[model samples]
Target: PKEDRERRGVTDGLLRLSVGIEDCDDLIADLRQAIERSARR
Candidate 1:
């Protein structure tokens, strides 16, 4: 399965998040922070 996923372009750094019933602004802020943090790395 790991090989298959990698073959399909799903590598180890792929992020899969499930959004629940949370505030849109909060989600946006969290996502922005996460993206910024990852970009810095």
Candidate 2:
């Protein structure tokens, strides 16, 4: 597990989210948060 979870240094900022029956505003907020966090890296 450690070997498989090691960082590959590929900062693609890929966001995979599932908006299943949730509010659109909430989904956008989540994506915004993810992008903001990634940008801080």
Candidate 3:
């Protein structure tokens, strides 16, 4: 499965997100914060 996914251009850095009923600005801020936090690691 990993080989197939790689062949199809899917990799470890891929992020699949599903937005719920939250406000767009809230979601964006949350995502930005998460990315920034991860980057610090």
Candidate 4:
């Protein structure tokens, strides 16, 4: 299962989030913060 997941290009840092009823500005801010945090590592 792990190998299959890896083969599909899903790495350890992958994040699967739910965007349920969130506003655009809020989502954008969240995404920017997430990307920034990932870039730091």
Q: Considering every candidate listed, which one attains the maximal TM-score?
A: 3
What tens digits encode model 2's per-residue C-alpha lDDT throughout 1-41? 54444465334554445569988898899889988998999
lDDT per residue as tens, model 4, 1-41: 88998999888879788898989999999999988998999
lDDT of 1 by residue, 3-37 (tens): 99999999999988999999999999999999899
State residue 4's C-alpha deviation in candidate 4, in Å. Answer: 6.8
Which model is ahead, 2 or 3, in terms of lDDT?
3
Q: Who is ahead in lDDT, 1 or 4?
A: 1
lDDT of each: 0.96, 0.72, 0.94, 0.91
Clashing pairs in 1: none
Ranking of all candidate structures by their TM-score, best first: 3, 1, 4, 2
Window of ten residues with lowest summed lDDT in model 4: 11-20
Model 1 residue 41 CA deviation (Å) reads 0.4
Error of 1 at 28 (Å): 0.3
Q: List the residue pairs that clash in candidate 2.
A: none
Error of 4 at 25 (Å): 0.4
1-41, model 3: which lDDT tens digit per residue? 99999999898789989898999999999999999999999
Show model 3 residue runs off by greater than 4 Å: 7-9
Reference-based TM-score of each model: 0.65, 0.55, 0.70, 0.57
Better of 1 and 3 by lDDT: 1
The clash number for model 1 is 0
